[model samples]
Target: MRIEIWADVVCGWAYIGKRRLEAALADPAFDGVPVEVVWRPFRIDPTSPARSTPLEEALADPAVDNALRVCAPGLSPGENRTRVSDIAAAEGIGPRWGAAWRASSHDAHRLLFLAHEHGGAELQNAVAERVMRAHFVDGADIGDRRTLAAVAAEAGFADGAALLETGAGEDEVRELLLIGKARGVATSPTIVVGDRALAGAQPAEVIREFIARGGHRRELPDEVERLRHAEALLDRRDPLGSLVLLRPLLDAYGDDRNVLMLAARAYFASAQLGRARATLERLVGDTPDDSYARHLLGRTLQRQGLAEEAAPHLSMAAAMSPEYD
Candidate 1:
């Protein structure tokens, strides 16, 4: 069976749905199955500047409303609830909605391309998960080349610099948008199995059946086992339950920035200006060009009574936020 998934990494459904598809493919039923997989291009928010914008700002933009609606609030990236997709992640065909909504698929998808170059399918999956976590969970910007490259490298990407170059390099991404339009793909998260199109966030069984039935069937569910675990944790509502669940997710995924960011924010919120500065400093070392990271770092400096030192960072952040300003 040949599985051709026409998806954008920015598409939360695609990020979530890809997990479900993987779970089904790992089934014993597919142990000996022959599968040919390909990732075609489709950009729902093709003109969204392809840059990493803060979630708060992106939500307010009128330009990509259609894209936002399709991705859904089910993919909402706020401080509180991410979504049912998150709680259902381990169940079978659900995603993790508890992350921030820094929705930009270009960087993440580009990592997959790099993964293909370095590690083939396995690496691709690893890179994909890293990107999802960065944008969704870590609340970091996947659209930022430096950030994406860091995550990719942590996921075992051999060429971090090379990957970043590709991420910042997206003439091909624009081409994919054209391909999507030509093919009549109206929305993102569209999975192409041969010529078959599977749209929206679907159940794992649907994915399994699709892959099992051979070319052009419903798609299979995500990993039932993982979703089951994630669901169990969701029901507990333990303050640290999700945190505990997040351990491995972070481990397999990239935990560096998210952990650092979470800690930095906590310190900042509590007026622990020194700690926040320290944390962000480390992140800057990892992703020197991340404007938002720099923005937060500058804020920390201002709070710490270091206005003079914060000037450059503030200047850069403002510049990045200003094309329309």
Candidate 2:
């Protein structure tokens, strides 16, 4: 079995997903199967400047708030550091999200590429894990060559400093990133087993089930692909484009949970509050335990001056995500 994971070192959910996959592989269900794991590069912020940003300022960005809410619903930007730290602790990694600096992971990806080239999968995995821990737990500026070199050295690279000085593996890293983008990898922690992809931080049981089923490729239909493109457009702040793509899917598969969720998000982003509310209300009514839907519905209602109605849903969403503030 071969698994390729597209993720960024700075992604908290990717770190959690890595741990979950590790646990799944450790299960006795696949005791004798030989599995090859490869880590591919995916930059969360490809255009982010190399300069380090203060954690507070980074977390305060609306984009960061939205991303955090996906993983830890109802969490305010100010509370995300604590929420991620707690998750890291539970996953057995040291907690230091509060102290971490925010920067690009481009240079770190280059180092990982070099690690894989020189020492194969074991060394590459070690370097990648240490780099994530360095960023999420040790507060290291992973974009810095010096910081990357130190991490690479600790992971058993003999000439880590020289490699960084010469900018080794930069081209390979860039190529890998291009490959990931071409493969519809818009999010971190996209684990690819054959043609099957498991997005987000899936639980161990889900991963175990996937492994048990032979990890075969399940190609997505054209409509699902369109929906995914719509989602990407929404993430890139092109709500109108997303809506244009989603309208057809909405007519064809209005009852699809993913389509409805994307439609709601598109409507919300485009300031179509009524449509957002209607779509989300239907979604929430069908899936009451969906914290994301509940939060979105609450926000939509609040925007329309229905605070009294929104309060219960918001409260429920927050209660469901106990780590949030």
Candidate 3:
């Protein structure tokens, strides 16, 4: 099993999430489960200054505090900090957040890519642990090359400073960042196994369930590709599979005509008459002139044995397009 974690190095919840996932993998139930964990980059604050700033000063910045607010909505910055600290403490991962600085994770990500290239997932995960600890526990400025080089050496990379100076992994890291964005990675510590993602710091049991659900590797990386894949599943007469792929797309694009139409068709195929009716109603209401939507709505009503309600839509659809009859 390949588990990919998209997270920022400085994210407190991400650190805690890592510990929880480790615990899950260490459980006897998965003793021989051959899992490879790969960490991907996500910058909570891409515009964060390269130079380190005082923890309080960084917290005062809107860009910094906004991420905190996202993690703990309705809580003030101080409250969010306390909440994160408490959660981390419960996970046995006490972060030295008092004097921690907020700096860009670009350099840290680059070093991570280098580690992956050097020794694949094992070396990369080892380096990631050290890097995250350096940021969250030691309060080191991860953006600093010297600090990162030290972390690299600690992770058994001897020529780490030279590699940093040469900027060996810059392009690879940037590409991975773009890949994460393309994959719809919006939150820190988004755990992705295949195309299915569990956002935020989920519990170990939840992570276990997510893993055991058995998802294949990510073949569809973007909205267009995922939509196409869903349609292909529908074509294969796998309505449940199509619905699974469409779930996230529906959440993100519920208002989209194509998405709604596809969902209605999938629901209808799967004998979910109510959902199909509701979706078709919404689509028909939004686009009264859409012959296909009207036709689908009529068919859905007919399926529910509401022939009286289906009459006008069927007539209107046939009137608009003869093929709809």
Candidate 4:
């Protein structure tokens, strides 16, 4: 059996999910099953700086919300930490989250990719475990290449830092990230067993039940349902989640008006101005009379400081529809 886990090293829930998965696999029911687990990248904070501020301090700022905030809204960071720590403690993995620093996980994912290239799945898992431990338990600066190399050394790679300097896993890590996105993996600690996926830090019992289903190809929702779900995510202010669901649709329905519109709206909401502008331009090109598309394109261009270019589109949209005005 094979399981692909999409997660981030710094995500507390992912750390807890790892422990839960281990416990589930350790159960006597699956004693003879040979399960190969592959770790994949999913950046909960894709735009986080390399190593800027302490996690505790960042969480204190209302402006800086992390995956925890996205996952469980209405709870403060301290409360979220307490909730995660309590759960992790029960699972025998006590995380010292207070000591953790907020940093980008790109290098950490790169190291894991390198580990896989060096020693296959076993080595990759080892590197991932050690890296997560370094971040959540030891509060090591994971964004720093030097710190990562030291962690890699502890995970059985002697020249880990030197290997990182070679930039070996950069492309592979990015490809893995794209794979996760294509698979609609919006949440961390998502375990994809066969065709089925269970997201979040699911309980051991729940995970075991899911794994027991074998590799049955689960039925996928139709495109209409998917578009509706993506639109709902946008309404909830979850552009990333919306994009995750829209990725496959964008590929399958690349020219569909509804798909393009929703994707463009999500891109705009997420501040991915380039993507938004491109998608809107495609929509406007396909149907020149689309008032909303013109208006959104104008807004997107304006947001990017192309005011002069936006004026004509904004004027056209207003002339076409009073709502745009």
User: Which has the greatest TM-score?
Assistant: 4
Per-residue lDDT of candidate 2, residues 1-325 (tens digit): 8888899988888888899999999999889998878889998777567888877687788886676578656776557666767876887877445446778888888887888888888888999888988888788888778888789889998776688789777766865665565467878889888867888878889988876776665678978766776787777777876787777788988899999999999899899999999999999999899998999899899999999999999999999986423
TM-score of each: 0.54, 0.63, 0.66, 0.66
Model 4 / residue 134 / CA error / Å: 1.0
| Residues forming the 10-long window of minimal summed lDDT in candidate 2 | 174-183
lDDT of 2: 0.82
Model 4 off-target regions past 4 Å? 65-68, 95-99, 216-325
- Which residue ranges in model 3 land beyond 4 Å of their true spot? 95-99, 218-325
lDDT of 4 by residue, 77-165 (tens): 67877887777778887535434788899988988888877787888888988888888788888898878888888889776678889
Assess each prediction's global lDDT (C-alpha) against the native.
0.62, 0.82, 0.83, 0.84
The residue-by-residue lDDT of candidate 3 on 1-325, one tens digit each, is: 8999999888887888899889878778788888999999998878778787877787887877887777678999888777787888888875454327878888888888888887789888888888888887788888788898899889887776688899798866865665566567888899998879999889998888888885886454689787876787787777776787788899998888898899999999999999999998898888899999899889889989999999999999999999976
Candidate 2's TM-score: 0.63
Superposed model 1: Cα runs more than 4 Å off: 62-103, 166-171, 216-325
Residue 149 CA displacement from its true place in model 1, Å: 1.4
Error of 3 at 39 (Å): 0.6
lDDT of 1 at 202: 73
In the range 1-325, model 1's lDDT, one tens digit per residue, is 7776677766667666777777768878888778756665666565556656666677677655545554454454341234545444554432334444545566556556556656766677677677767766566767777777688778887685585674443544444444454444665566666556777657777888776766544444433333333334334332233334334544564445665565555556657688779878888878887777788889899888899999888888778876312
* Worst 10-residue lDDT window, candidate 3: 93-102
